[model samples]
Target: MRITNVAFAPGHAAFYFDDQAAIKAGAKQDGFMYRGQPDTLGFEAVRQGGEAVTILLQLENGLWAQGDCAAVQYSGAAGRDPLFTAEKFIPLLEQSLKPVLMGLDVATFRPNAMRFDQLDIAGAPLHTAVRYGVSQALLDASALASRRQKYEVICDEWGLPVNAHPLELFGQSGDDRYNAVDKMIMRGVAALPHGLINNIPQKLGRTGGKLSEYVTWLAQRIITQRSDVDYEPKLHIDVYGTIGNIFDNDVVKMADYLCDLEKRATPFELYIEGPGDAGSKDGQITLLGNLCVALKAKGSRVKIVADEWCNTLTDVVDFVDARCCDMVQIKTPDLGSIHNTVDAVLYCKKNGVEAYQGGTCNETDISARACLHAAFAARPDRVLVKPGMGFDEGMTIVANEMSRIMTTLKAKEAAHVDQPLQTV
Candidate 1:
């Protein structure tokens, strides 16, 4: 099927006040409160008077593809909040995507190689968030045209589970940071009930007192909260180069903290995300090796997960080949297509490494549905699906469209599977 039309819908909305308050209160009880506005950190608070951007693509024969891009607010020291403001990336979508994608047969697009040359040409200066938005649209369109769930298309083609959670945490507060953590947990529980929640904690530097203490405290909280659940929530912490300066010593301390948490009868699994600037390739490998040794010595089951350092499937393959980590986190935009993202997951599987899908903070329902399809299809070890939760008339419409797509695809799949072969 061909892409018939591409549309951009950009707008704003208010956050869910009650949800934000519940999150803030939970965090305060755990000693984490807003360093900025009282309820600003929760979805309801930040969405108040802010814009939410959505992009939709329609295919030939009236099929639909859509997603959202929204900015989330956070409280932290200056330059450290992990909010994703979509303005920097929307222009790429607003520009003529039709020229780049129209008339091209969706069946012939090589999802894996499409981004390789582009990424190489762009080098490290790539606009990750923008690339992610554009790629998500393409995946949605491709899935709709192919008559497959985005996740199924991704998994069957790429070899990984499409249902992994991509947890994002920003800031460096001690137990006092519990509000953000609580909100994240609640949201994960609410939005992605069937998926894994990969917790990516912001880093603590060499002078780590409260930061380290907080990591330990939060680990305990997760363990305690999940004790009764059938499957303990999956967690991954992002050090973001904050631990690079101290390396082994910090890893050891982190391991100790994790061991203590596990000792509390909390069976949750934990993974460590590599630092962003440590030359993610070599740095992540070395760090994972060191972490593995330390965890082995302490008998901890914590695994190492590659994130920022693993921008491509090749990078992930290299890391796996080197025995650097246990899991490879697939950042879809960085890979540039649903197919390639699936390929990355498959590459990880080939090497016996678990794969998890990561989400861009600026994703909309169209993108989330694409992600959901990818997750469902691949059935990855974990996934993170985030759609800006706001009250927008357009947002509601986008969601309805997504549900329709899912229903249509499932019906078509069932029909094909049940059909008897025609006599030649």
Candidate 2:
């Protein structure tokens, strides 16, 4: 089959990550600066809706495969213009890459011929969102070409075992989806308000008090509650490097605070992500490693998850090689291609670093389902709930995909068991 026509359409996203953010200190269109970031993005106004663009590829085979692309509803906070990304990305595809991809054999489309993670179509670094959409379209076509599920294609290409089990997932609830409250009480899916960027005092709605206290109360509440599942709900928090806001980048103070937190949240461990971001990549790796080491020395079981500066497969390798954190959230979009994502997971496995196949609330259903194959093939420690942050939408997609794959495996096993005995 040959590529025939490439098209793009603008749409609206069903989910917005901006609601909870606007309730915090930064309420203006030009409010809140991510630490170490050069600009201030308007994260507040996106509550109305986020920009979504749908891509359709018409092929000579008379079949079509769809791709989804959307920036965070809070694009203003990132200092990006949504319309510009939409326009620039589609043409970049038509000009630099589409010429090569169009009319090419679907079976022979080499995905890594141009690596978006390292370069841009023009003179600038291409946004991961744009790269993500095209990469997904090609992946869908590849699966169609191979007569297999998209995830299976990656599994086969990387030589990952097909029968590996599904990855246990963690969810973070937002807006109208308040399952985190119930899920926590049931000791179900682990939830963090905003990973590291959330304001503990604000999210919990107390005028004055320490973040550690709220975390303690949260831990106490969850620990006291029993559940059918034996797993203790972890109090995972992503600081967005704002822990430094509380302590001014004092790693020693951060360690001391964690020690106190350990006292209250006993038996229930904490997975703290980006407690503080050191200004540079090396600084971050070293700082995170130092925190882990300090916690280890104190016999504190708190786990550190690296997020901010760890954007690509190379970053994953560096962080894992340096023993930066106990686990790495492999944000799938940043890889730009499924092949590199597979490589990142395998690298984490080879080096003994625990992995989490992570995606954002900004993704779509197609992308969400595609992630399931990776989660099962690699069996990462956790897979993030996706498509949207709403508990209903996200849980449905992730749970169904996991259930579908695992159920298929069981059916196959049962068929084998029922087979008549045969001579070897």
Candidate 3:
């Protein structure tokens, strides 16, 4: 099938975009908003409502494939793309990309996706968010044209085994660390509260006592609230480099603190994401590499996850090859094309590094669903809840999509198994 028309609509994402640099540089919280000016360019305030554009491709056979162009919450930080406002990008899509989409064949996906992903405008590629959404639409179109699922298309193209089973879901708590943890526990998420520990004073504490107490509380709370006695969820928290900042970026001191936190989270595994940001990709790798060695030397089980400065497929490869961290957050939106997310996950798993198929809360349901398909095909170690910070909303969207896909795949397999043999 071929794409007959291209249409788009400006829309809002499930969450807000926050200037990560501004927040890390001491932007005070002002009741769900930051009380300071934005440190990043293209941002008017420290926090603003996130926006997206829903791109719909009308196929010649009268089918519609949809995708949402959205960016991460911490836009314009850690070598990421600038903020993605629907109005700012809609014209580019219309003038530059819509014509290209109209003439393309939807019988395949990879080459079409790469065409848009690598399209150069004025000697530069399109914005990551634009490429991201465009690729999703192409993947969806390919699936619809072939009468197959998105995950099936990915697996078929990449020559990977189709993983019809559900992946482990990791939940993020935003700022509602305590209450959100309860919800995640009750829901039986394999990975518990992300615990946005970005700040040193408020969340991580001056001497790191506060985070220790919080981890202790989290462990106890899980034991108290879990209906299943054996539901031992791994405690994964994103510190955003607060531990490194508080400890003066000293690898030894950070290792000591991480060991302590691991003790507090006894009988449960702990993963700390972005433990430190060295402000540059090489610097981050060096710092995390040293910290990893230190943790191993100390016999600490706390796993470090690379986030900042690790934005692209190349970055994922570099970080994994360097052996800097135990797991890599293949942040889907930052990687631009959905295929990159898939490739990154497969790469991580192929190597010794674990892949966390992660995206942003400042996404939409469309992007989240696309991400889920990629995750299913790639078979990442765990997939994150996206499009929102609310524990329930993101969880429901991801869980339902996973359930539907698995149900359909199982039925299809059963039907194939029960079919009669042909006269071959």
RMSD of each: 8.8, 5.1, 2.5
Candidate 1 ranges beyond 4 A from true positions: 7-58, 62-64, 67-97, 107-131, 146-148, 155-231, 246-267, 275-280, 385-424
Candidate 3 matches the true fold with a TM-score of 0.97
> With candidate 2 superimposed using the best TM-score fit, by how many Å does residue 95's alpha carbon deviate from the native?
4.5
Best by TM-score: 3
Query: What is candidate 1's CA lDDT for residue 358?
Result: 61
How does candidate 2 fare on TM-score? Answer: 0.82
TM-score of every model versus the real structure: 0.62, 0.82, 0.97
lDDT at 20, model 2: 32
Candidate 3, 189-222: lDDT as tens digits: 9998999998888999999999999999999999
Candidate achieving the largest lDDT: 3
**Count of steric clashes across candidates, in order:** 36, 12, 0
- The positional error of residue 329 in candidate 1, measured at the CA in angstroms, is 1.8
Give the alpha carbon lDDT tens digit for every residue of 1-424 in model 2.
7778777776655565454334345443333322222222433233444555566667776777666665543343322323224445666656775565577566632344245345555677656566556667776776676666666666566665676355666776653223464653553675443332455455422321455666666665565665544667666666666665567667677777777766766767778777776867788898888888878887788888887567777889999999979888787766656556667778888888878788667777767776676677666777777766555577788878888877765665668754322211
Please state the error at residue 253 of candidate 2 in Å: 0.7
